[model samples]
Structures are given as C-alpha cells and as structure tokens.
Target: VLDPNSFTGQEFMMWTVAVYGDGWLNFWKELKPAIKTVAPGWSEGWVKFTTNEAPLMVGYATSDLYFDEKSSDKSFIPSEGGYIYIEGASIVAKKEIKDGAKLFIDYILEEKFQRLMAEKNYMLPVTDIKLGDEYNRVPTSTKLVKVKTKDLEKIEEYKKELIKLLKK
Candidate 1:
C-alpha cells in the first residue's frame, strides 16, 4: 500500500448530473482512486482540499489543467477522456440594462476585460491571449502547461489506466 503522507497531489473529477451535478458521492468515487494511486494508505480523512479558496469563483479542474504544483510528478491524465465540468455563477440580470450598464457588460465580453480578469482574478479567460509572465507565475500556471490541440481534445477521455498498472 502507498503511504498517505507520501502522496503529493490529486485531481478528483467529481460530479453528478443529478442535483445540478454537485454530488459528494460522485466526486468521492472519482477522487478516491486518484488519491489512492498517490497514497495507497490514504482514507477519507487523510485528504483535505476543499472549494473555499475562491468560493465566489468556481474553480473546476481539467485533467489537462492540474491544480497542485506538487502533483506534477503524480499527475493523472485519464486514458478514456473526461473533463471536470466547473459550474460558476454568472452576472446576468433579469432584464437587460441600458446605456453605461449595458456598455460595461459589453466591455466585459471584450478582450481587454477578459485579459484583466485573467491577470487580476486568476481565472482563465475564454479569449485567445498568450498568458503573460504575470499570470504564469500563479501556482495554477505551473500545473497548466497547455497541451496541443489534438491532445487537449483528448484530455477529458484519458483514463490513464497506466497509473493502475504502476500500482502493481
């Protein structure tokens, strides 16, 4: 069995279509195995990393997007392919605003605001921009060295069954 303390990191792909996809059991099943791979001796209480860092901002992880920098060596890229879907709140309004309010919303959709959000908020912007050094310094960046287009597409499906074989 692997040592619990010896574990470096894990990216548990937690989710459930029911309850709007926020099911702990669903998350546990996916995460438990990855954690076990890192530390076979680990149990539920042995791990602790919740979603309180930026509670307002949902931080969903992609297999291609690792979270813990220490996990680089213990990374798990699934072979069957599956992406961790992150659900975040939107700033939508019941009714569209007029004038400056509308302009401000429109501006947010622009590249300028997107880059600023990425730089200041530490959230990846949907826009296409080379993440500058400032943004790259974050621990998140260390885990997310972008993969190629083809590889990126295949990330969610990756089963990384090799990890299981390694346990033997």
Candidate 2:
C-alpha cells in the first residue's frame, strides 16, 4: 500500500513522530544502562557475543542457523515483535545482458536453486521451496512484521536520530 506520491518528506516525518512519540529522543537514554558497550560494527559485536563478553546481541533471526548443528544456542523472535526481511532478485535496468539477468532471476525462483539457497545460506526461500528436517529445528515466529517501503524512505533519518541519541 505504498503510494509513491503520498510518501513525501513531511509524511515520513509525521509517521515517525506518530510511531515513536515525543520521548523518542529518550530511547537510547532508557536503554543505556543495559548496554555494556557498543561495538563499531556487526563483526565486532559477534566477536564480543562469541567470547561471552556480551550474553546477548542484536542480530538476524537466521544467525543461529550458522551454529545450529554445532551449538546448543538458538535465536528466536521475541513475542513483543520482530522484523520480516524479504530478499528479492531483480534484473538490473539498462544492463547490456538483460536477458542473462532475467534468466538468473528465473533460476533463483526455481525449486532446486531455492532449496540450495535455503540450505547453504540458512535463509528462508521466497519461493515455495520445501526445506528439510534440519531447518525444522530453527525457530520461527508468526508475529513478524514487514516495514513499508514508505517507512524505509525515512531510515536514514532514523539512523541519524539513533546516533544522536546514543551520543548523548
């Protein structure tokens, strides 16, 4: 339901204000006590988590799948809420090899290719690919929500606000 014309900068700001409320600036202030240390990036955060320096870290739900066979640890979407990420394959416009790109996109949607992606990448297939028993152990949630494309337009602003809040 993303109407390109309706998603102006003013609308995006209003949406953010409505969803976050007046105390949005205090978000990081409230969570600061629980945060041990903020890593520079995801790799550093993962290292900290693996070394037991941090018991918990923010990461994708599929993260635990990497250690599923070797570790007892698991990742789950909390009951409060979770994000649904949809990965898509698209043929690039104005590409010289447009036909080749289309073929690649078509191949990605095929069952065999989708299955391979699910097994190797530890990702849920966008297609109707059936996963094996191994994937059953991975936890999934029904309460996941997807962000609208219009909302995504404000992501940079949100990130800037988050950085400013964290700095305080």
Candidate 3:
C-alpha cells in the first residue's frame, strides 16, 4: 500500500526512466501493476478513464528525466532503452510543387531553418541546431544517449512490414 505518510503534503513525485519504442506498451502494463501493488486503494476508475472528476496527471510523453526531478520523491528506475517511432513523410499527388523540392529539403537541413522549425513546429530537429533552453519543450541533457540513425532506419523498415501485414 502507498505510504500516505510519505506523501502527506507532497504535490508530486518524479522517477528516472528511459523509453524504448518496443517497450512503450509494456511500460503501461508494468506501471499499472506497480501502482496497484504500492497503492491498493487507488481505484481502477481513477487510473483508467479521464473525465471531469478524475484528477488529471499529465504524464510527459517525452523521455525519462523529464519528470523525475519534479516528483515528491526520487524513486525511479534508470531505463537503458531509447524510444523509437517510425515516422514517414510523403508528398500528396493533389499538392502541386510549382518550385523545386530540392530547395525545400536544403532549407530544412540548414541550422537556422531547423531552429525555426523547432520553435514554430515543435517537432524535434533532426540536426544539431541547438534550440536553446527557451524552446526545449523536453528537458533533455547531453547525458541522454541518443538512439543511432541506423537503429531508427531499421525500426522504420520493421514498421513498414507490420503495416503491410495489417493491410493483408
């Protein structure tokens, strides 16, 4: 059971973690059991559905260290895996590209444009262009081990296969 005494006046707690693409669903399964084992009184309704009556806990959709330090206690596991998602870009046939597409690609690669992309689009830049503290929605440090580009490419390939299988 959760030690209510441990959280008498505490607002929240943080835990250290790492998220991997394959492990995302597993994390939720594990979290539910952990929460239950520690806090048996925690109603299933409270944790499942999101409604007006439910106390909202905005779980950060980003990497680990994001919420740990903000928690009431420092009880978190250090995860070794990195999150992986297969995202693809496609140009629709309906959309006509009057100008050259190479120029658009070059602009996207430039640091200046990437910084602006992060600020305006909020998508993580694929380049090393530092979107300073002001624009960093996710608080990641140099310490965060980055997932290799090759790994991401493999994940993308796997995702394509999975999609093809589903279509059949």
Evaluated with TM-score, which candidate comes out highest? Answer: 2
Q: After superposition, how far is residue 164 of candidate 2 from its true place, in Å?
A: 2.0
Q: Name the weakest run of 10 consecutive residues (lDDT summed) in model 3.
A: 8-17
Off by over 4 Å in 3: 1-78, 86-99, 135-137, 141-168
Indicate whether candidate 1 or candidate 2 has the larger TM-score: 2
Report how far off residue 91 is in candidate 2 (Å).
2.5
Question: Over the stretch 36-129, how does candidate 2's per-residue lDDT look in tens digits?
Answer: 7666555666788788888776656777766747786777766644655456667656647667788888888899988988888877888776
Best by lDDT: 2
lDDT at residue 55 of model 2 (Cα atoms): 79
lDDT of 1 by residue, 58-115 (tens): 1232212334444432323234333332324345676765677667767777898888
lDDT for 105 in candidate 3 is 67
State the C-alpha lDDT per candidate: 0.39, 0.62, 0.39
Per-residue CA lDDT of model 3 for 50-109, tens digit only, reads 333433332222322233445442222124422323234444465676455657767767
For model 1, what is the error of residue 147's alpha carbon versus the real structure, in angstroms, after optimal superposition? 24
Sorted by lDDT, highest first, which candidate order results?
Answer: 2, 3, 1
| Model 3 score (lDDT) | 0.39
What does candidate 1 score on TM?
Answer: 0.34
Q: What ranges in model 1 sit over 4 Å off?
A: 1-59, 62-77, 84-97, 133-168
